[model samples]
Target chain A: MNERVGTTVLSLTGISKVYGEGPTRVDALRPTAFEARAGEVVAIVGPSGSGKSTLLTIIGLINPPTAGSLLINGEPVITDGVAVANLTTMRRRELGYVFQRSNLIPFLNAEENVRLALEIDGVPAHQSRTRARELLESLGLGKRLAALPGKLSGGEQQRVAIARAMIHQPSVVLADEPTAALDSGRGRQVMELFRDSAHAHGAAVLVVTHDHRTLDLVDRVLEMEDGVLSEKQPA
Target chain B: MMDLAVRDIRNDLSRFLLTAAGLGMLMSVVLAMTGIYNGMVVDATVLPDTYGGDLWVVQKGTQGPFAESSRVPALLADRIRAVPGVERTRSYMTLNVQHELGDGETLRFMLAGLSWPDDLGNSLPLAQGRALRQPHYELVADRALGLPVGTSLRLGRDDYTIVGITSGMVSSSGDPLVFASVSDALRIQNDLASEALRLERESRVSRVRRSEYGRDPANLARAGSAAPLPVTSPPPVTAILVDVAAGGDVEAVKASLLGWPDISVYTIDEQRELLVRGVIDRARRQIGLFRALLVLISAIVMGLIVYTMTLDKMLSLSLLKLLGAKQRVILRLILEESLLLGISAYLVALLIGELAFDLFPRRVLVQDLDRLALLGVILGLSVAAGMVGLRKALAANPNEVLAS
Candidate 1:
């Protein structure tokens, strides 16, 4: 499957992050190299304070790497230590994010929450609404389209968040503990959704998680320890 | 942006409306203050408007007839009318008096005396019945006092019939106007009290004369017949009103009147300035201060409310930023909500203002132009208020989403 898909959706070389300088200086992430090809779902498992979040944020273009180069869809977004253009626009065009909590806008209903991303991208309102409804229904949230975030249960909220993340079909999707609040069964279901998202939409999915039970759903598994990353071996 | 704002307000419609209504009530008070000032101006000019006089001739060195007391001869109207370029002349007198209804309801009224002949330019415009036609015992009262035609009331030992009724007739101080013949007003205001005093003095003198010569009736009759008591006449009028001939130079007429050392003349413009700047100066300042205070309170209240709403949505806004929303998107959203709040409050304020105007004891005049101008000001101020919330929203950090 990796041989069939030759394009790299996200790639990073010598990526490093430093908090401050001198005595207060803290290296959140050491210089590292990473890549994710099209049609692959990669999982990063680590203990707390392992810099998994910092690495994900740098890859997602939320925080610029202190020393590195980043490429999305084979296009250079960051060279050396500076961004080429507007990072916000770049993030909106190429990246999708799902946080640990559902983080849905409480005022908006499920469909509206999904449509907001497209609306931010300057999509026409009518088209955005229709696409949001279709995506939510595809995720088995058809009846919950008009329900506000507070009205939905834990699993439903996570599913709505998933729909929002995948609404724009970006080149890469970065999710941090996407199902930390759900039970084991629901967590596995969400991980399977990520796998399907990568294969069906050809998106490169990167998820940071502690749930080892859903490791079988990803094409490759990596481990982070004190800001360092290495591929995991088969059990 | 509008759609998003509309939905957000609809989601919490009760909270949004309550905030808007509170703001609207404050704005209504602002409107009421403005209306009160307008009403004061109207009241200040109502008497002059009713008289329609081009110039006023009063005692020298006086601002009469509203701002100061002036006494001139009643016969001056004839001389003033004879001056070149003088179209017409009418001697007028105004006495501020309290009419005791005998029920603890003492109503302040302006008793105005106008020239006779029952013609235009001298009589008040009646809303019902006829103008004052009788010389000594007729009155035309303002309808605001609820005085009906044919109602008779005693004024200074004389029963005067209400022969006419006029609307919108008020004094410079907002007292209702009551018009009567010049002689009737003069006698009622000046002669009646002096006449009573004179009779009492004569009676006392007669008694003293009888006491001194009680033993001799013939001597007493001779003394009473030999020395007659003196009579007191009514005091002169307050001012005389003059009209300029068609297309006449009012300055020429005024200059001619200045030659008379005992009297002064004023054009319409001069009287208006005296009334607004001099007469009502203190009240205007008070009203202006109240308006400024209300506006300041409105801005603070509006800004605080929007800032609080922004605080409430801070978390959600941070999540949006994390999800890749641009700063403009978030800023637009907050601004749209602020605009909606402002417009809604203005609408509620207009309704409340109309209701309050009808119930206020004094006149509250709300003009259409005034309302529109107020609305524009409120909307603009509301937008200014949005900046407070916009700043809060902009200061939201997207990294908070990860921290949570």
Candidate 2:
């Protein structure tokens, strides 16, 4: 395998993003460069209104960079730092995301919600349901399979979210303040789950968090300030 | 994934149940409309069938007995009886009148004058007691009137005893029917004031007095000088009731009666058509409108629900998008959710409709065809609602997941 492909599941070379035309324009991210590799856990930590969310959005392909190229597994998907159309398909097959509040479907139980990710992919009912149970059990939620979101605790819900992200076995998982609703202990436990999921399952996991107590859980950490990515410590 | 619609439903039973309950009420109304229509059709035609006539003989060119007034001499039964196809014939005097029960509750009733004797020896299927056999005083009433047998009622200035009560024999207007002997029927067929009868008697006396004064009452005035009056018998009944033979062709018999009088004839089938086409059309149209309105409201509800659910799961949608879940998949999930809700509601509505019908006096039919049609409508509506959610999901940006 090529070094670029193995070392980086996602590599953004000098990406910059700006909103609007002239007077109302804003630069949410300015010439940021970063890479996330397979089997590695990374956190993007920043305070509120520090362009952290904007940076995360750009990396997640929700918004395009104004400049720079983005490559996935050594394949260039963006050129001149501008996204081409048809990005929706590219993101779905390659990426997974976790949100701050679990954001689980209230109508669906833990297993069902996780199963929805597979079902949305056109997986057969039996297989998807089976896989959902497997994932939930693996996440230490074997007993909460039939329980609805209301019945599950904050930590359990996030664990379900993690299971859903990995259910499709995507190469990359993105988390946006995944433990914001959890207490310190549960938050730390959820962070460890992501770390273990990435390394043991060969996934590239990028988490955006405000929880610094579990910073050591990640293999590497990326800090952004006014839209620039800086490496703080080696893996 | 799209199949998880059922799974989701199972997971959140309470939410599903509440939605179904609301939906069930709507369905019940729909079913009731169908039942009411059936009742209307049956009620309007039931009277024509009871008369046991192939055709009605009336004054020409008018729909009589129920819709208009028609009168012919009571003697016409003789001529009608001689018709070739009229194997057996009977005369009757029918009138619609209001009677105040002993309890002071007024109800409309049909006064029937029966002429011919039957196998029961001029009797009827009575709830209690016997048939009206006496002239001017005996009466037979329908059991629905809640009147007791052997009771007496005042008809105009005359009092008559209720000798019997028949079950299920009602007029077109839901009035209870009463049977009186032909003599009494003809007597009160046209009621008049006591003063009017006395005045006519005094005129006769005046004629006798004038004759004694040596001037003939008829010769006392020129043709234009005096208001001329003629002595008359009571006006004949409006129409006669005849029972056609079981094998008799009603249309054929109806054609024969068309030649008899100043009235028009109507068969039971013809009566049904008139009711549906003339009187009941407007109500049917109203029901159609209500059905459309209900469908529109239900569709809007589904759209709003799916959209709200989508908004709640925006982050998850973006995540799915990032993981290469197709737009179609997301769209399917939204649609599936809607369809699930619709089906659940549809079933609930039918159940409620049936239960309501059991308790209510009015008719309500929850037909299978209507239920199937509702299912189709709900499925289509849900699919539309899902599209709204799909649009929202597709609007989510995966880049948000990567943000710091």
Candidate 3:
């Protein structure tokens, strides 16, 4: 894990988001510079409506930043506020996301939920199934593979979500309050999984969370107030 | 690749199957309407098709025997037979009568004169018994009338025994057809109750007393008696069916008969056209309108169902989009689900139609072409319905997943 610690996996320079024009204009996210290296977990904490979700959305490539240069694995995906490459392909091959709710597709079982990510990337069914089973087993969900999201508990569901995110071996994994629905113990377990995913798998991890009980599990903490972001060392 | 559509359907199979079943019931109605319309066409043209005559002669300026009222002299058959190129001619008469079934239940049917001894209804499609042998009391009844062979039915003061059972034979109005000899049909047409005979005799006597014949006591006395009045000539036949000699010019024969000035001639095909296009045109329109409305209703229902199912899966779709799924993936999911639902419903409709179509009062002829055409329509409708859900799916914001 330490061998790949210094490798830069994600970089954003002067990233900002503005919603409207004239008086109706609102700054959802202010210009911010940030980076996460392999084998590291970075946590973003802020009050309600403090642009944490906005920042996460931009980093996830779900929404375009108004002015920014963004790079993943040393390749420029966005430069000078314009998408230089296909954002969807970049997201599919380079990024993974875990929402506040596990957001597991209700119809698909735990194993299928993880397999779908690989399928979207055009992986063959046998390889995808093998990879999904291995990943779910590593996440301690082997027995619950055929169980649907509705049939699983909160922690089990989040573990399945983590397996789904890690199945594609994306360079960066972003979580927006992934443990908001889980209890304290389950939330801590989920944070430890995120840490292991970053440290062991060499993926750059960023999480937006209001819960501070799991703060020590992260390597760095970034605080956001209104539309501005500021970094602080993890306690 | 994983079949996301199939996975979703299996997740909620009961509801999906139930929805398909409901839609199938509606589609079955549409199929039934199409079948009824086809049956009507068959019923209207069956006689002309089965008669296999090359030409028909009817009263001038009339469509006759099936579509309009026509009365040509019974002797017109002899004249038509003498025309050039005419090989054979037979007198044809048809009338609708209500026959009592001995239990106060009346069966209304169209009684057609077969010109027996000349035309014994041998050309009719007999499903069970023999053709008419005796001209007077023998009848060939359509199976739709539910009269078995050898069953006696009372019609116009005479009991006629069912000799042969014809299948799928009906009038333009969908009433069953019963064939009897021309003489028996004529007698049935002319039969009257005893009170009506007395009234006729009194009227004839009064007419005789007022004329110059009143001075003759013998004529007056004979007119006042209960004895039946002497017949002047045989009853007029409805029309004459003519068969042209093989290798003969039917058009020339028709032209020769057209010169009579009192009768009109038509080729068999023309007579069929008159019956289909003129006799049952209104019914066709009515049934066609119903079928169109049913199809429209089915489309609307299918659209609503697909839209609602999409609505239920909006979050899942947004999640898939956020997970970097291409737009076409989500579109395929919705479209595939809609298509499966439609195909399943169509199969169910076929099963229902097979089970219930024969129970309808009118014959239901479900032709293969009609079935294939309807399947094409259903496929088209399913795709069109899928569009309703696709619009909503494509518009779903992936950012919603972040908020969730």
Q: In model 1, how large is the Cα lDDT of residue B310?
A: 92
Better of 1 and 3 by TM-score: 3
Q: What is the CA-based DockQ of model 1? A: 0.59
Clashing pairs in 3: none
- Candidate 2 vs candidate 3, DockQ winner: 3
Computed on alpha carbons, the lDDT of every model, listed in order, comes to 0.84, 0.71, 0.89
Candidate No. with top lDDT: 3
Task: For residues B141-258, write the lDDT of model 1, one tens digit per residue.
Answer: 8887777999887898889998888887877677888888878888788645766776766785577576855347776665466364443434688888899999999998999899
Better of 2 and 3 by TM-score: 3
1 against 2, candidate with superior DockQ? 1
Clashes of each: 0, 31, 0
What's the DockQ of model 2? 0.46
User: By TM-score, is 1 or 2 better?
Assistant: 1
Model 1 lDDT per residue over A1-235, tens place: 3332547988889899999999999998998899998778899999999999999888877788899899988888988868986788777778888878888888899999999888888898899989999888888999999999999998899889888888888788888998788899999999888877676667788999998988998888989998889899868
Give a tens-digit lDDT track for model 2, residues B110-181.
Answer: 877776453121445566788655555888888777789877788877988888778656665567778876
- Candidate 3 runs further than 4 Å off: A1-5, A20-25, B194-230
lDDT value for model 2: 0.71
Question: Could you give the candidate ranking by DockQ, starting with the highest?
Answer: 3, 1, 2
Estimate, for each residue in A26-125, the C-alpha lDDT of model 2 and write its tens digit: 8878887788888888888876776777776666677677888888767777888666636666665566778887767676778878887777666887
TM-score of each: 0.92, 0.79, 0.95
